[model samples]
Target: MIPKVPSSPQAISKALHSQRSKTFNAFYASIRSLRQTPVEPVDPPSPADNDFILSILRANPSLRDTRSYLASFGVQPQRPKTKSEAQLPEIVIPPPPLPKTSPSLGKVSTEEQHAPSPVIHSILNPVYKRTALVKIQGPFTDVQLDSITRGLAYLEKLGMVSVIVVESDDVPKGDLEERQLLIDEVMRVVTSLERQGSHARPIVGAVVRLGPKPGAEESNTDPTFITPETHIFPSDLTQIRSSLRAGEIPVVAPFALDSFCRSVRVDANDAIAGLACGMVEAGSDNPSEDIDLTPLRLMIINKRGGVPSYARSGYPHLLINLDQEYHHILDTFDPRWKESHPHSFSDLALARTCLQYMPPSSSAIMVSHKSPSSLIGNLITNKPAVSSSLPHALLQGNLRLTPHTPTLLRRGLPIQVIRSLADIDQVKMTTLLEQSFNRKLDQEAFYGRLERTLDFVIIAGDYAGTAIVTNEGNPGSPDPISYLDKFAVLPSHQGDGTVDFLWVALHDESYGLGHPFSANPNGGKGGKGEGRDLVWRSRANNPVNKWYFERSTGHLRMGDWVLFWSDAEKRLKIEETRRGGAGLSFIENWESGRLGNWAQVIPKIPSSWK
Candidate 1:
């Protein structure tokens, strides 16, 4: 007979949280052990407790490797008992070898061309895979279930997956009988192709819990029964990887805590995280292995897959690169961040560098927070050629806020702020401009003008738009000014508030550098008494002038362009010093810094651009 069920999704969420917390705690502990830097302070040893366990540890010797609770706070390994042992220096275990890499994606051997293919590891290659992790999410209707099955079948076909692990713990709030049904349904769909005579081996291993015989709970008075904790069996992962290597899929239904003595409550995420940490530990020990032990990526699929909880626009996702910051990211979500367990999606996405995990070079993971339908094409589509396979395309639009609002961004988009021309790779920046303008920029001249020293570069929407702000004067100059060298919004997003946002953000950013005659102590750092007006130029015929006039203090048509400045000031004695002679040389000198003639390449004043 079936047990009771939760009536709503909220009820299921609560039940899932309670059951998974224990497992998650354990997984978190395991990750902390492998982290390079301690996430939290290690408590000092307790005097009395240390003496008691240290003595036992000293007597039993080999018991050191087995027990979880011993002299955890105080005991150090017992000193050598024999003379030879005492004479030995501290034994240093060398690190494991790194993974072997090929120049590109080349064959291990020409003769075994038909062998199951795995992604080739590329060292120093920015876009190649070092590992891949898969996360299968649930809560599907019959139709969605069919789509999921097809997606899995596609993976089985491409040989992209090493193994697919679906355990009872992964199923939402349900009884043992319901959990079994869930497992069976997943296996049948995944292995449907096997019945069609396909070479794929979808269901090869089933790991179910055993033992903890009745009355075992009565015999054991473990504290865990009161407050459950995460527990991962080494055998589970060992068996899972083995099955995959032998071309079999493993579905693990881990035993609930040994303390519970019941065949209920499974935490799949706890197990998955445990497996990831284990592989990291093992791979660290043997980096130069002929065979890869861990999957390159470990994905966690739930309601929204890998999408963030909130976004300012549609098409939001975060493709996190877990290289150096994985531990930091894990730490935030690891209970220690706020000293609480992660119970919701917001807590899970806890890091603000976007955390980088310890996958080998060129390896990265993408947490897709969208729907399962998105995964369908990514899994089944033919492996497309690299980026160079296509011609370059034009890009425009810019988003840069001084005090970064990290949460406001879409997923998988990485942003960098360049403070100076030296901070950028000129060749690359020039290419970006070429695309934005749809006309090639003079590379040498662009680089030379960049010596004016850019103050900041804000690229948002993944280089779709950018603003190049430059520092334009010597401190001793009569009029020191900050110039907006280039500001372009893509034709597509011209009036979408991108320009307005930048204008306000840049103004505030400049104001914060300190202003002339302002009592706000923090306001006027730009060069007190030197200048307060921020200036730039636009084409005289450009329609954007209408909008510029509305915002600027004043504008003067100087030949091809109109010189615009914030209304905070009239003429500056210092600006006149810019060229000694008249005829708008200051404006003309400012315009000379850019490559490609502005009049020839710039867009006409569209209503929206204004």
Candidate 2:
């Protein structure tokens, strides 16, 4: 059987290469040799046939039978997985809640508490919500009619809503019919002003009869005289607020209703005070409703102008600090002046009373009918037309003085006078002078001069301002010449009327440490204490010369300096006339000698600067 094994190389090659049986015959012959089993060789498939079988199997769709056949050869198939099974599930997390806050430690301030909410309309919270309560004393003259209307129109333009009260006190104290006539006249004037103006806003007259203070007697009160109990009841608060909200200027007449609800006369000052107090009280009572109606200013537009002072030689007081000088000014009024200056007394009294009930920031203004425009000017600038401390000589046409100058009033701070320099802090004094002058000071020279000639020093409000006066004349002269040595006000306190306050102290005869002069101008020890003949010199180029020139009685120019003096001759003429002095010739000679002495001594005074 597996007989005749191919032993020759040629025979083996022939058997391997033959297509009938490839390598199978050889493998079988070898197996036969090992086990002695008889096995026959089989034919192998052709390459072309194997290709045809693979193509046919791939093309056929119904190949289920082929899978079974492939499984016999140990083959397995895999199914595709879905997207849901492959991807991970998402888990969302919300942000942590906002942390809770604790309440604030500080309380809300008065201004902040009264501040209007954002939701409030412009009508409710106007651009200029601050009110100016104008109390017009007496009827408007033909000349004042045009100016007052113009002033009111200007106030409207400046965003101030005016509430005018026409006082009928000056009109002959008559019955209700007369009061009504005065009201109509005021209405006519207001209408004329409105028509003459641009007529952008409507001007209306409100004829409201005011009521007396609660729990007070209903007895008839004179509109001309002001009493402590005189005040308007706050029944007209709603009417005022509503009118103001509507952007109207209310011209109110001063008439009050009695217990029987009949119209009667009440003090004009009382009406003004009541309206002001009502506005303030309304805010306090219902803070949400009348929040924006608080009056910032009370303007007493007087036809007679500001309060005049005999101490100022018939010049009006430009400013009044009611807290300290109220009684002092009241005392200065001669009993004889009561009839002549009735309006002056009433205006001053009214200002003090009205300011007492108003907020501290509020102020009362008294301006002349000659310059009614100053009402809005004062509101815009919050300053007087002139400094209150100007000398009387300057006011007498020496400087371009305004007869219509405005008078400002407030509850101001107290002034302190130090007769000796030893009491003042030397270090603070030096520092203040340096700051005010914006230059270095010769401290030794200044202190040395002060010690030798220091008459007195006046300090205003914690050394915010200071003035030093010195004796420049000979020790034994009949009229010891007085000189203004130094005047200094801290730069921080400059524009807020500190210098004016200091000037008031320096010229105030009552504040002098030496005997006050009844007619003498020199403010020196044991000299004519009746006057203020203060002499001082300023550098030729000093900017303060303009102010000096305005306040000085006379000035003379030297090479590098200008000599200025407030002499008794020009200023004390009124006093002399009041005294009916027949010794004018002798006094003139003595004043002439003092002037020569001042010219000689002022040049020898040492400079307090390096």
> Top model by TM-score, which number?
2
Candidate 2 lDDT by residue in tens digits, 473-508? 654486567888888888776545566666766766
Each candidate structure's TM-score, on Cα atoms with residue i matched to residue i, is: 0.38, 0.56
What's the lDDT for residue 516 in model 2?
A: 29
lDDT of 1 at 584: 47
Q: 55 in model 1: Cα distance from truth in Å?
A: 63
Question: Over the stretch 1-610, how does candidate 1's per-residue lDDT look in tens digits?
Answer: 1124456666555544443322222222332232221122122222322222232222222212112112211123443357886787977754222223244534345333332111111101112112334434454445554544444433333334433444333355655466566656556545543442233333333333333324435755533221112333445456655555565544444334445444554454443444444455555665443224445434344333332211112221222322212232343332332222122333133221112222322122222223322332232211110111010010001221111111111112223456666666665566557665667676666566666555677553445456676666533345445666776656543322244334433443443223321211111132233234456778678766776776665566668888775523213334546648873444444335332232222222221110
Regions more than 4 Å wrong, model 1: 1-132, 141-143, 167-179, 189-235, 254-264, 284-291, 302-315, 318-452, 457-610
lDDT of 1: 0.38
